[model samples]
Target: MTELTPREIVRELDRYIIGQDDAKRAVAVALRNRYRRAQLPEDIREEVTPKNILMIGPTGVGKTEIARRLAKLVDAPFIKVEATKFTEVGYVGRDVESIVRDLVEAAIRLVKEQHGRQVRGRARAQAEDRLVELLSGATKKRKSANPIDILLGNRPKEPELSPEDRDKLVVQQDDVRTRLRAGQMEHEIVEIEVEEVRPMSEIPGMDVNMNDMLSGIIPKKTKLRKVEVREARKILEAEEEDNLIDMDQVYTEAIDRAEQHGIVFLDEIDKVAGRGGGSGPDVSREGVQRDILPIVEGSTVNTKYGPVKTDHMLFIAAGAFHVAKVTDLIPELQGRFPVRVDLKPLSVEDYKRILTQPENALIRQYELLLGVDGVSLDFTDAALSAIAECAWQDNETGENIGARRLHTLLEQILMDIAFNAGGGDAPEVTVTVDKEYVEKMLGADLHRKDVRKYIL
Candidate 1:
């Protein structure tokens, strides 16, 4: 972060997004401020508050992409939430504070990924030892034979073993260990005890008991299975890893990292801004915004994991404020977002750049998609211009959805080719959708004002 200037950040963002320079620059400056704050005195650092950003733009205009890319660039904990998904407290729906919890989870994952890399070498050695033990059954404790052994009918007799016999037994044990490590006896079956654990879903939306409240009452049973030596090694290695990791420590560091660097991107926030005060849903929308105000303004949220502070954490909120203005949000909530950047709608040149310039351009995306079916898709330079012109015209005629218009325009243009895709094998397909082709497809309809009014 210290190494990157705001201009460099914008440069990185430009690779993926076509335009929206204002929004990109605003976020870049906000991010750089975070790095700047870190260099301040400790006492002053605590006094510094993050300047949250509110991005207003239509969908597919790089609002979400900018926030997402910003987090990726900084390697920070990031999450995106829709404003409509949340409701006021006491409501049956999700509470806005859940976004903070989700951000904490993301932070934990990031820290865990870093920690895993740090512990890889040590973990590998431990895994190898566990695998070797599984292969040779060394984990089983050896019991000393009783000296009264020769007791036949309660009569005790002194039994002596020859030195050579003892030496031979030691040699045999060593040879077995050597063969086990050398993969010479990998196919040999050995009895191993494995715990019987019930399978459960980890998906959040699914009906699964995450707390495992009944686990204490349900006794764990052991099952013995005869598995090949090599296969058993892998199973044992995983068990060993589980034993080595310290959950308490991981959770502690995760919470700290989350509090420090987690980022939450709240999308469609204007929906919850509310139009002054109204009844039913509209009233609750304002209530939801009020509830979220404190969290965005820097407050501690309690999660099942632990209490996490949101102070100093970056919050990037975005919305398509076509209906409600940003000012409609409660003053407290609006104040929380000190920085605001509005994204501009795309132009024909912007659409053209999107179709050709980006690494994942529309042309490249279609080519890759069709290439799976042993089909090669090639779009001529003129075809791109035609596509952009038609898209721009449609936006002028109807509701402007930014870059999303391209998807509709491209799909309409290639409908016939895509529909008859696998019918027959052709030698090659070269399509040049010039101005003439563009007129041919959309000519009559585009000229008709009523068609533009309705179809568009």
Candidate 2:
């Protein structure tokens, strides 16, 4: 994050999201500010907060994509929530605080994965050793773990073997270990005990997780199942990694990471923009905004892990603002989002660039999807122009869905070819989508769109 200057950030963003330069520059500064704030004095750092951004644009534009990509670039704990999903207090709807809870959950998973990777090599070796014991049927003896077994003297009674027999058993186990390590016993079946998923009782409308509450108090139960050696090794390896990890450290670091570096993307915020005192469906719009205001303004949210501070966390709100303008939202919520950027409607050339540019371009995606079926997909430059023109014309005539119109157009054009590929052992085929083919397939739809201009 420190190395990513505002200029470099925009350059990186260009790889996936095209255009929206204003939006890109706004987010770049916002992201860079987070790092800048960290360098301040302890007393000064507490006073500085993230300049939350509000992105206004039409549907299918790059609003959410920008926030999502920004979060990924920094590897922050990110979660996107719909503003319409929550309601005002007294309404039976989700609370806005759940946003922080969910963010913390993502943080926990992220930290666990990082720690798991660090310990994976050691865990793999240990799991393989256990697998060899299971496969050889010359397993080592272990003490009983259950208190009932200790109390009733119900432990397994073992027959004492002579030293010569034990020596012979060791030799046999050595041969089995060598084969197991050599990947020669991957298909062999083994029986292992896997932990069962814990079920917990919970009451409705509660924020607390009942399962998490009882996790420490209840002892986990395991059941034996037969699985191939390859699959068993994975299960055992995961358990071994769990044993190696310090979960308490994970919990502590995760909470800190989420509190300091979390990103909450509030999408469809325009849906909740309304002046107060309205009745019926729009009554709760301002109410919802009022509720979201506190979180963005910095508040403490309780999670299963611990309390998380929203002061340092970044909040990026986006909406199409087609029906309700940004001014329609309550002033308090509006003030919380200090930075605002408007994403321009995609042009025909922008659509063409979107279809071809970016690391994960639309045309490249379709090509890759079909490539798995041994179908080589290619699109002529003229075909791309035709598709982009169709998308632009459709947006002008009907819904202004920005770059998303390309997906609909391309899917319709390639529907038959995708359906027919890889059904059986057929020779590889090459499909080049040309302008004539696009016109032939979408002629009817394009004609209908043309007719829409005549409607009013």
Candidate 3:
């Protein structure tokens, strides 16, 4: 984070998103500000707050992708919640405060995984030893004398093995350990006791979990089940890892991480900001905005982990605003998100770049998927131009869903090929997608046109 400046951040974003430089720059600066704030003195740091961003854009225009990728880049705790999913304070069981709780949970998961990786070596060794014992039957139960055995002239007794016998058992255990380490016993079935964690009862629209409240009160139930050696290793390793990390430390660090670095992307905020008669659902929408204001304006939300402050956590709210204008939101909520960026609709050229330029390009993804079945795909440049033109024409003529139209058109073109190829019995073949192939496959399915003017 310290190494990535706003300029470098925008450069990284350009690799995935073709256009929308304004939205990208806005997020980059906001992210850099968080890092800058961290470097300030205690008093000054407390005074500094994130300049929350409000994104006004249409759907499928990289609004969610920009925020999601930014969080992944920095490994920040991030969650996306639709503003409409929440309601006014009193109408439903869910309130705006649950966002904080969910963010805290995400932080805990992220931190715990990091700690798990650190302790995996020790945990793997421990789990391996336990698996070896189970495989070799070296671990035993105490013997008990039985009346039936006495009546049959054979009495059960606890055996005190001689040194030679114990040495032989150790050798057998070492052999088992060697084989287990080599994965030679992966498919071998072993009976192991696994504890069952019952899910906490849930209420509709409620975030309260009873499992946290019953931490030490109830005993966990363990049941023995037969499983392969591979599955047993994972279960044992997870249990060992849980024992290695400190819960109190995780809670403290997670709460701090959530308060400082959390990103709550409030998507579809226009739903709450939609114009209404102010008598029906619009009233509840107004109430929802008022409720979200305090949190955005900095408030401490109590969570199961601990109380988390939203003062420094950055927010990026996005809405298509097709019907409702940004002014429809209550002034308090609108003021909380001061930085606003309006993303432009994607052009035909932008659609072409989206298909082939990103690190995870849609075309490459399809090629890889088909490659699994020995089907090689080659997409010609003309075919790309044709596809891009079709996507743009569809968007212009019908609902402009931005770049999402590409996905739908591509699916329509590839449906037959995908279903016919992946049987594992077919020979390896190459399917070239050219202009004529795209036209023939999508003839009349696309907007009927005598001349395709946008084709490059």
Tell me the spans in candidate 2 whose CA falls farther than 4 Å from its real position: 140-162, 200-207, 275-282, 450-456
Q: In order, what lDDT does every prediction score?
A: 0.76, 0.86, 0.87
lDDT of 3 at 41: 92
Error of 1 at 240 (Å): 6.0
For model 3, the local distance difference test gives: 0.87
Taking all chains together, the TM-score of candidate 2 against the true structure is 0.92
Candidate with better lDDT, 2 vs 3? 3
lDDT of 3 by residue, 1-456 (tens): 445999999989888888999999999999999899888899888999999999999899899999998998898999999998888877854799999988999999999998989999999999988888788876665365354664466745556879998899899999998888788999999988889868778655554667766655554556778999999999999999998998889889889888988999999999888484454556777888888998999999877666789998899999999888998888788889999999998888999999999988999999999999999999999999999999888877667799888889899889888999876478999999999989988998566643455557
Question: Where does candidate 2 clash, by residue pair?
Answer: none
- Candidate that would win on lDDT: 3
Clashing pairs in 1: none
Q: Scored by Cα lDDT, where does model 1 land?
A: 0.76
Give per-residue CA lDDT, model 1, range 1-456, as digits (tens): 445899999999888888899999998888888889888999999999888999988887888888888888888888999989988888888877778878877887777667666666677667555545555444553243343542333433345559996676556657776786687878988767788777863544222355355555544455777898777776665565556667567778878777776778999898887764455446787888988888988898876567889898888999988888887888888889989887888888999999978877887887777665556766767777777877777676767777888888777776766676654565455544566665676666445342455554
Which model is ahead, 1 or 3, in terms of lDDT?
3
Q: Residue 326 of model 2: what lDDT?
A: 85
Give the per-residue lDDT digits (tens) of candidate 2, residues 1-456. Answer: 455899999999999998999999999999888889888899998998889999999988798889889888988889999999998888898888878888998999988999999999999989988887787776644555675665566667667779998898788789988888798989989999899976677554566778867666665667788999989999999999999999999999999989888999999998888743456546677778888888889999876677789888999999988777788887788898989998999998999999989999988998899999999988899999989889998998887888888889988999989999996688888998899999998987765554665677
**What TM-score, to 2 decimals, does candidate 1 have?**
0.74
